[model samples]
Target: MASLNILMAQINTLVGDFEGNTDKVVACVQRAVQSHPSPVVVFPELTLSGYPPEDLLLRPSIELRVAQSLARLCAELPAEAWAIVGYPRTRDDGLYNVAGVIHGGEIVAEYSKQSLPNYQVFDEKRYFKPGSLPCVIDIEGVQVGLSVCEDIWEPGPTLATARAGAQLLINLNSSPYHRGKRGERWQLVAARATEAGIPIVYVNQVGGQDELVFDGGSFAVTAGGDIAAAAPNFEEGDFWLQYDSDHAQAPFSGLQVYPPLEEIEAVWRALVLGVRDYVNKNRFQGVVLGLSGGVDSALTLAVAVDALGPERVEAVMMPFRYTSQMSVEDAAEQSDILGVSHKVISIEPIYEAFMASLEEEFAGTEVDTTEENLQARCRGVLLMSISNKKGYLVLTTGNKSEMAVGYSTLYGDMAGGFDVLKDVPKTLVFDLCRYRNTLGPCIPQRVIDRPPSAELAPDQKDEDSLPPYEVLDQILEMYIERDMSAEAIIATGMDRQQVQKVLRLVDINEYKRRQAPIGVRITKRGFGRDRRYPITSGWRIGD
Candidate 1:
């Protein structure tokens, strides 16, 4: 039996760092050659320019840099093995997302991606022209097919390669992580393999970009739609598989399959990776957040410490007139337990100064939510000032439910460099808190048990203005994610008036969400890129 060794190099790449990305590829290739003789190395899509370079692809200098990087790879790549890598290619027609095969220190074959995903966080159509044909290459007398990330999702590319007499398929990817996305990928790849009647090797990139985190759960499936091997998610490494050609009927064997992560663990790891990469890549000294001993802030603090450690995290408790004694005590306790730098700052003086300055403008009007919002703005100003002075990124703790109903005050509680829970719902917030406690008691028991509140007004609670989170989250998931109308939501045994009110809040809050900081996206439709609605639209639910 002739055995073929294949290496899947799942790497973390920085956007537009051509030299650095190339260096990583060269180093991996050298290591692969030293460890395994005559192996075919596969890397993720656009490994050179990183995934979704956004408008960086439009720059002219990017083309030159890519060319230079490819040249360097050709010179430095080990000649003992074959390598498959992804990058952007410039042709007379237009630019394309391409995968190239390298052997004997030269480019051997190239495959342009046929499917261009333009929805959600992807804008590939804005940059590249799609290819119409499939690419098949011959490696040591074995026929192999090539596909990019989106190519296998559709039917044509993989089928075309199969019809072209390929024995195996290698798909390179930069697919991002969302809840249950790993299972979806496996099912899709399994179907593709079965339809093509050939085994597949799927390699994906792993790391965090601005708002996207690629969980490298790379794997392979046999032609019979059985998973042959699987790599761990949220990790970076080289996963190996051996294909025995001598057993022509059953070439895939001796697979190493890693277990899948549960929903809570997967979401937690994604948040940690996203926060860590954003801070490290942007070169922030550390992170700081206003802790109110609430579930939201507590979860944000825990995520920050886990991402960068306690030494890099600072917790500030800003107390106003409405602040509860329990909140103060709990915040201090959590800080002590986590060993983070904890400080207590009173916002009363700042609020007083602001009210005095606005007395003349507010002479005829009684106090309303304006005063409540002022308290939040005072804390926002303090946090931002600290961030500016100490090079710390302020982590805002607003959840999806508040952001949906405009419960968050823009430039007040919404002010920060990054939001750790922007896409997380309120119910999920409680669940994640409980999950964190299972690891250890990082969050206070009282905080988790107590009712949620903003503490900006006297005896304020979240439910006083909005519906219960359990009800609110359901309506939101239906309307925002599933695109159910207000009438449709009401049909599910919800009150018509309540449904209308929730929908209206979401519609009016578009402007606020437009200015909100980018956060980790854990769902199919996040506010930033996935769900884009016009702020000034006249379209209403029943219209």
Candidate 2:
């Protein structure tokens, strides 16, 4: 049996950054050639322009630039080495998410994606034409089967490739990270490799792209359904594997390693990377947010400081007349500890102006929730004003639990360039605050212990407007994520009236979510793309 050395460079690449992505691929190939005896190196799917170009793939100019970039990458390839990369291939049928195998400055083999995932943060079918055949290439007396990301998730694609006389399967993946995805990926792909009796290598992309964070838990499994070698998740590195015919497959030793089982820390890291990359890739100077001395803004600021450094992150304390002195002190202390630039811009005068403007219609109301909402909008206007003046992107600090229950004010706190915790729930928000403190008390301890409040009105607590987060998050998980009916939610030993009330708020808040900016996702069901509900939905009834 012959031996083959394969190098998988799980490098971080940005979306739509053609020059950067191309340069990355070229550098990786050079490193691969110098470091290992492998003649072939594999990259994550869409390595030339990053994964899920979204609607950017639709632009003809982008496609042309991608093609030119690929040509440039080919021009720099060494004579003895082969590069297998993923890119977009255009044809009469439309565009295809393709994998190109380039050897000697020419594309030797190209395979289009067979299964385009359209569910759960994916819209590939809308943009890509499916490929019907398998692509195989021979290198160093070894037959390599080629398939894209989703193709490996399904069984038939892998089997079809193996049956077409391929000895080894190499899958290029840009699989996004969700909770417990690595275990699931290993289970399915290992099962597929066992069934087909072929060794499988999975390479995933690393780094953050908008709401999506691709954890490069790339790995290789043997034909007997055992993990062989794996890469580290949430980081970038070059992973190598040596395969020999006579050696028995050791029981899958180096399968991917996750964070120290600290799930909230993982969430925090993902958020930091997401914010850092999104801002850095989009060419923003820095980040600005309305710091109301709440856990949500506090956590967002911590994440921003860790992600882009405190030098690039700015926090503005937008205090209203009702904003408490404790809120101010806690926020200021947090800013001081995090060592980021801080500013105090009171929104009381602006809030008074809005109330005066609406004095005619709100005369009989005697200053209600409308007044609270006005304070938020005033803060929003001020944050945006600063954003426009300094060219810094405003980061909204609303969490998923608030957004889910419509407890947030639209065109107000929901207004920002990017939302850091839009997909994180209230429970997770508390957990993250606790986690941040464990890392040497970055967040003020009082900020984590104090009851959550919007502080838009005097003596206002989150419970005043909504149910307890413990009960509320449970009810929400059942109804929103699990698709439980209101009756079903009540069956879980929850109060019927509370269930009905929470359901109503979630139903009415669809319009607010529709108007919200895109936020970092950390849950199974998030507001942005994963969870879709109609604004006109009337699917609930009073319990």
Candidate 3:
């Protein structure tokens, strides 16, 4: 009848907010103790400092802050419970990402993360000195092993811990979200559990941090690679699982694993969570995005309202000569439906004024993208003004497709503090718009049905300048995300001309993307921190 209660502390943490994050830890431990006796509570990696603390780890105060917080936890926590939480441990050699076990108001055991992920949005190697040993401690007559985020990804630490006489294993994580990542985690963890023959419990952080969003799809798996329990994705809460020695074959019992989020649904939640945390964490009063009648803006507006609510979101429609009457109507309609504050400020006068002022400088240049860019700049100015005055964040609506090919104008449409769809491609933007419609009446149906245009030029269709989004997005995914070369992509049956054009655009547009705002990253490689390319490069567009 020997059994243990495990509480998964899937909580959101603000990076560098030691006091606040510690408060959450203390509260969670207290809450778990009240309900379950001698509960084994596990928190995500870097629980006190938050994940990807980035350069904040370099500051001298990091050691002080972590020590203070750890001391507070030891003093405040109940003596009976065993709480395993992640924090950066400083040693004479260097700093290490360690999961420390707190029992009876003191850290009884510690295990530093062995695998420091350095690629693609992670730079842990720059900060942490990897640990070589596995830590297994006795908890309530049961032996448990400990590891941090990246340790579970590799076989070394898991196998090493299992060999150390551990009957159970606990891994902490601050794993970020990308489409299809959850499935990858499930498969990988199941393999580890089956190989080690030790039932494992995984806990992950939930919430957004800058371009990164932790989905928190924590779970437990049996030694035979079967799922025993799972926490929901893109949420923050404490979920419990029971481990009984008597039922070794199916020891986990308190919670059952449910179906994970579908890919599209998970992406939508990632966007919402990313936007919400970016705004709230930065302490912005609210968010204001340009609600052009275009699909991109329409989708961005819907996400904003859903993330921050109608009261905290404001939509401004700035129209130019090319801006259609239908565009105006649809923007107003959606805004009305969403109950967000909507304002229409015609940019015609602003455009005219800019043109008039630049008349002398633009002596004999034939009209081109410059004029179209001026229109976008006009709207950018209006939005930035509102943002500045009202203390609201200006959310740009440029999609990844436009961002990939430099279709946006710098200091024009790209002028903003944040871009919600910065990582979402145009094709997916429409899908999300349609998806939002399915949830409720937020985006207008016509907005989803209509052809996407910048409305910068009369009779402008995005396809007129660039290829159709369906083709463009596919190529972009191959080139940017998959890192496929133009020839490789063309050999895969894509049109050579379109592939060349897209690759060329993507390569040359690094300057523009460098200046673009940070947004949610839902793909394996987003334009932000996920994909890093130099603005200045002599590299050609070939393999």
For model 1, give the RMSD to the true fold.
Answer: 1.1
What are the TM-scores, per candidate, against the unseen true structure? Answer: 0.98, 0.95, 0.99
Give the alpha carbon lDDT tens digit for every residue of 52-160 in model 1.
7989999988789889998988888988789899999999999999999999989999999999998888999999999988889888768899999999899889999
Local accuracy of candidate 2 as per-residue lDDT tens digits, 157-193: 9999999987788999998877667778899999999
Mind giving the per-residue lDDT tens digits that candidate 3 earns over 1-543?
A: 668999999999999999999999999999999999999999999999998899999999999999999999999998898989899999999999999999997999999899999999999989999999999999998899998888999999999999999999999999999999999999999999999999999999999999999999899999999998998998899899999877888999988786888788999999999999999999999999888888988888888988999999999988877889999999999999999999988988888899999999998889999999888888888989999999999999998999999999999999999899998998898888888888988887888888878888889999998999999999999988898888889998999988988888888989999999999999999987788877778986643
Q: If the candidates were sorted by their lDDT against the true structure, best first, what order would they fall in?
A: 1, 3, 2
**Model 3, residue pairs in steric clash:** none
Question: Considering summed lDDT, which 10 consecutive residues are worst modelled in model 3?
Answer: 534-543
Candidate achieving higher TM-score, 2 or 3: 3
CA-only RMSD, every prediction: 1.1, 2.1, 0.9
